[model samples]
Target: MRRAEYHCAAHHPRDWVEDTGAEVAFSGRSNVGKSSAVNAITGRKGLARTSKTPGRTQQIIFFNLDETRRLVDLPGYGYAKVPVQLQQHWEKTVRRYLEERVSLRALILPVDCRREPTVLDWQLLKWCAASQLPVHVLLTKSDKLGHGKSLQALRQTRESLATMPLVSVQLFSATRNVGVTEARERIVDLLSGQGNGRKPA
Candidate 1:
């Protein structure tokens, strides 16, 4: 474990932690292994709750790395079973956070390895590009595929988003602890403002 602890949960901007220092956020669709990736990266099992059910994470949850650094878990998107009004609220809230939070360093986007990126995923990537926010894509559940398939998925993702200079893609499998070290290093670089993507305007 990397000494991570729950910091806070925010339902709105007023509920967000003080915008200072640097923090990296995890965003993904429901049931996409976002929580698994967080736990793997931190070396702390169960640090973020994992569930088979969709729409479990309803608020923006924050985990503290230290007083000056943090990890944010944004609400899962693209769950149709969730009420439409609530979904709309989440969309508005997430967009505001992405655009306005100064402490937000980068976004970690987890996509299922078996399929192409969802439309909502592309929307987020484009949004990050417009804001110059660096994004790291984790092809989660990669252990389900053979080595060749995993590599192919990674290459395809990279090729599809080649025009987006700030977006990077890598194969990841929380069950096998794949790419955890690389993910951690990339996060550190982003927090230290060393990533290629520029800060949002």
Candidate 2:
């Protein structure tokens, strides 16, 4: 695939691009390395800007690999110091996009490997489950943990989601280039309507 290029950013659904063609979305808590993972998987440094400050990404940013394929970066949730009203707006916007976007193929959820999935993470998972949307969880920042702890975390996350067949989890470290290939392949699978093990609703 060609390198993804910046397409657009939308703060409201009315600003969203035409909802046609396939796109996968990446979402996670603030400071979870979501941008880093996007850059690693696309092999394009700085494609998605990384920021030390939480709530830096305040809009829905789009990166297109081609006319028909794209990747979306959603505003980070949880732990952002943004105002409550703004957070509520983002929550509604993201939920609407996830539930209604026709071209969205799947969701890529990144969480910090050093910590268990947070309450907001579970809420997103539940939303995906309700829609039967395919979700792949990336245990980001895996390099911070020892090999054993990383594996244990992965196993525990898998076990926690054992009842949710549409959700898959894996350890990833964008800084170390670990699991980048697998994540890319999974994105490809999802875009082509293959991965996820079930048809989207």
Candidate 3:
């Protein structure tokens, strides 16, 4: 498996890296433990920068696993104190990247296991489905709940998205290291061109 290292950061469409090689994007609502999960996956403590305040990271940070594979830390949505127009711009930026980036192979979505998918999360799912893109979801922060609750969350998430042929869900906990190995294996496969375990729906 490729060990990810800090690569580059892009805040606007014009600044994005060259559109070559494969990329897998990580995204979620603010404070979804996304930064933590990303850190755990890459074995880099400060690589993704865990935020004390949600939605403060305003740019897409890229981490390279190799010359041809990257992990994209997309700016968190849904809880920043920024102006409405800025939020809209961020949304547009993320959507445009997702839609137009030819090398983007998969998405790694982190949703708080304690709650249902946020509106932005749903919008992303719908958009990826329409784009025939593959997605893998992490029911993040599962350690906050009991094992039964965690399993239930995973099951419910799977059930809710069962109709989506290229989507898969798994429980994750950055704090306790739960599901870390599984997530890494899956990600390695995705970055290796195996993709999300199926063809588009």
Task: Give the number of the best model, judged by lDDT.
Answer: 1
RMSD (CA, Å), candidate 2 to true, equals 1.5
lDDT of 1: 0.91
Model 3 TM-score (2 dp)? 0.93
Model 1 agreement with the true structure over 1-201: per-residue lDDT tens digits:
298888888898899999998899999999999888989999989799989999999999999998788899999999999999999999999989998889999999999999999999999999899888899999999999999999999999999999999998888999998999999999888887887844432
TM-score of each: 0.96, 0.96, 0.93
For all predictions, the C-alpha RMSD in Å is: 1.5, 1.5, 2.3
Question: What is the Cα-based lDDT of residue 146 in candidate 2?
Answer: 95
Better of 1 and 3 by lDDT: 1
Candidate 1 local lDDT, residue 78: 93
Off by over 4 Å in 3: 195-201
lDDT of 3 by residue, 135-170 (tens): 889998898999998898889899999989888888
Structure candidate 2, residue pairs in collision = none
Q: Following a full C-alpha superposition, what root-mean-square deviation does model 3 have from the true structure?
A: 2.3
lDDT at 184 for candidate 2?
A: 94
Q: How displaced is residue 7 in candidate 1, in Å?
A: 0.5
Q: For model 1, which pairs clash?
A: none
- What's the C-alpha lDDT at position 178 in model 2? 89
Q: Which stretches of candidate 1 lie over 4 Å from their true place?
A: 197-201
Sort all candidates by lDDT, best to worst.
Answer: 1, 2, 3
